[model samples]
Target: VPQDEQDIAGQWRTFVENNRLDAVVCIAAALRRGVLDEAEASRYQRPAVNLHQPWELSGLGQLHEAAQNADRLVCFGGD
Candidate 1:
């Protein structure tokens, strides 16, 4: 079976933390979908996003309050 992208990305978290991968920004949705930028994505099976993907990293500055809550984080709900 193909490895779950989320699951695979999860293990990346440790590296992110140990390496301090706080650089760059991720879209809330992409984070939720298990796409980490060498940090957050690899951390949790659940996403750390609190917003939607449309915000994207580039325009995140526009979503002031939303960006603040980005790291608020959320665990994935089991089906």
Candidate 2:
């Protein structure tokens, strides 16, 4: 999904919840782009966190694990 689409209210939450899916945000990528979760926000003394529930900030290892365990995997990226 596009970066702008990410901040849209409740879309990701509802989709993930309804589908019983898990979403992980890459920690390094998120921090680099100023997309912080609650803990990160507090640690960095930021006033707010844009990333919320139904979406968790995690390392790429989690993504690898998820992919390894998934029945189907669809990845989108550009080198």
**Strongest candidate by TM-score:** 2
- All-Cα superposition RMSD per candidate: 13.8, 4.6
Please give the lDDT score at residue 3 for candidate 2: 68
User: What TM-score would you give candidate 1 relative to the actual structure?
Assistant: 0.26
Report lDDT per candidate. Answer: 0.49, 0.87
Model 1 residue runs over 4 Å out of place are: 1-6, 23-25, 28-79
Clashing residue pairs in candidate 1, if any?
13-42, 13-43, 36-41
Per-residue accuracy of model 2 over 1-79 as CA lDDT, tens digit each? 5766665556767888999988888899999999999999999999998998878899989878988998988878978
For residues 1-79, write the lDDT of model 1, one tens digit per residue.
Answer: 2554456434555566667654234467565565554345445654454433222243356456555778764435668
Q: Candidate 2: where are CA atoms >4 Å away?
A: 1-9, 77-79
Clashes of each: 3, 0
Model 2, global lDDT: 0.87
Model 1: weakest 10-residue lDDT segment is 50-59
